[model samples]
Target: MESDLRIAGTNSRPDIVAWAASEDGKVVPWVVIEIKSGASSSKPEFVLPQVAQYASTLGTADNYVVMGTKWFKADRSFRRLEPVSGPTPPPFGSHGEVDDPAVVEPLLTNWLASLTREMAPRELPVGLPTLEGFSVTNEAYWRAAMRAIADTTSRSGFAQHSSSPLIAALVARLIGNRLEGLVLDPFSGVGSFLWAVADRVRGAMERGESPPNVRLLGVELEERTAAIARAIGEIAGVPTDIVAGDAFRVELPMSSAIVTAPPVGMRLPQPYELLNGRVTTDMDLAAVDLSLRHLEEGGRAVILLPRSFVYRSSGDAYREYLANEFRVGALIGTPRGAVPGTSFAGVVLVIDKGDAPGETFVGQAADDDWQVQLGVEGALTKAAVDHLDGFSEIWS
Candidate 1:
């Protein structure tokens, strides 16, 4: 139940701060836990440095770092760090391991639970209304739940879907700092894009810097989905307006930056005005066109579209329109199944409204390592920018 414990008299917040009770009923710090997400660096060598730093601050040699199913001890004797897999008890060599099996099991369980809660909030903040009455308050959990719902709904061929969290974060980083005024996600789905924006702002604040001035606007056609998006925005403490309506028909202000993964292969009831009333069936084009219409001059858009939208013969007009009207900044190809439970390989298209580029940068992501590829420090580096393709154009 020490999930909410904070390090006393210090700004540093370790992932989990375990405590043990003494004979006099005085509580004492037992272990410092640092949990890394699956997307993060799980290798002991990569994480132990930071764990060592935290241990130094806590003045405890009983420090541990948990990454996915792996755990490592941070101490002078920290050598040959190997991750212990499965839900079973920690091995004997684990840092701060207790002698009794009964005593250690509950401690490890509580620590894991604490890690989960830290990563995703356990309880929903009071007074927020949700579409589904489910009480799970974790952002990552809800995103997966929404994706599963989309999979079931996709059976009817009504919804396409949003990007996975990894993809969404990558798209947001590609749009980095260019986001100004209102940020729009026309097909918000479960608000992955919006949450990415909030996470960026939150990350900046956490680093003791001023958060960028940006507002989020998400339009989801389904009311239930919109409610979930709204709840996510609230939980993340981001100012967002989630509208339940068709994005094509919804009246919205022009945005400085737009980021979204619009549903593909869906037919719209009516063609968007931005498409000049010529194309109505292709939702992908409609999405691109809608983003173009709402995006202000000098503003930018980072959109996720099916790879066919770029090279397929049927999408020639869309490609031509994109080339003529917008400057192609970068096109990043993602591996198949990056979205999970789907075979739709995708491309991240960075479009600028002012001038069309003579040459566009194109690259394919080798894997879904967003933590390093999209990390605040890691993603913004010159080499990372160049690796993203179109670094010269984007920075120039």
Candidate 2:
């Protein structure tokens, strides 16, 4: 059995490709499986046809479509294709439903055999080393590959690649060089910040240095996106716990540091119940506020917020609260269009559990120059470090 197997010379990659063994131990295509998530459009009428179309290319009728947990086989006995129920289990884990080995084992075995036969004559490209091995050995290559994947999959408004690798590295650096205990990301999309920290820690270890033992924790609202982050972490050999649930409602462990880029312009369905009867409609600010609660005293938090957050009238109360509760270490203005989808410029707000500063350091970068200043090497420049360190005495 193969999952997310890309069809040869075709853009359509089926969710699962199964094979069966012949009498002489030859593998042959057994079935093509297309699975739709519970939140996706997986109606029988719609998916059956799509699966059939994919199967037609393989010159086989053994195609199966699974929507959520319901599985259906396409029946072409009549003029129009009809869907018939099969012994296959419904979406795996729906309502804690377990797969019947008596029904599913044979199906999977046959599929695997078929796939083995189909690949017998093909010479595939050399696959890259596993993410864990490659990342530990080659930091540059791993960072590049991660950035490429992030850029390719990022969607404009729904899910954007907001944090740059440089920015992530800088945030991790500010949090601390040796981060022991838990590092939490309230809005970890693809685990960029987690990955950055992992790379840094692993690099130190590789240099014959003793880095603090750090555990990564992330909470994402979307299950599919959470799965992606988990997959990336697994490949990179980073021990990560990514929970697929509402961050506002989830119970979080006390963290040594927090770094995240909360979604922008999103309104909460209801007021979040924070400590001391505090509630707010702004999800972005609420995310930051919630993160603060989880941080241990003296713990650092690096967050990305819209530039308007500094001056918007609606944010006055929140800003005042931030001023009173957390030390405003620095506010680095990011170039416009820094984030892929939106024109809303952003600022990196660094906070620590300490005495509030009399003023916040404010710095700006030009659009064209920002690319150079925010790269891996650029992040370590004296100017860049100073901006993040609140070295400048400028007041906000």
Q: Go through the candidates in order and give the clash count of each.
A: 0, 11
Clashing residue pairs in candidate 1 are none
Model 1, range 1-396, lDDT digits (tens) per residue?
233334566565677765444333333445677778765654556776666666666555467777766666654755545454422332332233122222223332333233223243535332332223122324433343333333333232223444565666677777754766789999988677777777777667667877768899999986655765675566565678889998877797899999998886576776554454465567887788889889998888889888888887766876876777668877877767666446877888888887645567776656666335534344433343454343523311
Those runs of model 2 whose alpha carbons end farther than 4 Å from true positions after fitting are 1-147, 153-162, 273-278, 355-358, 379-381, 384-396
The candidate that achieves the highest TM-score relative to the unseen native structure: 2
- lDDT of residue 72 for candidate 2: 62
Encode model 2's per-residue lDDT on 1-396: one tens digit a residue. Answer: 554344566687677765443333333445677777665644456666556666765543367667766766666531233355763332221122112221123332333233223243334222332322111223433454465444443344323533566667656765643266788998887677787778767777767777677889988886655765665566454568888888888898989889898887888998875443566787776777888889888678888778877887766777787877778767778877776567788887878765555566667766778766655455433354464454422110
* Candidates in order: C-alpha RMSD to true structure: 12.6, 15.7
Error of 2 at 39 (Å): 52
The C-alpha local distance difference test score for the whole of candidate 2 amounts to 0.62
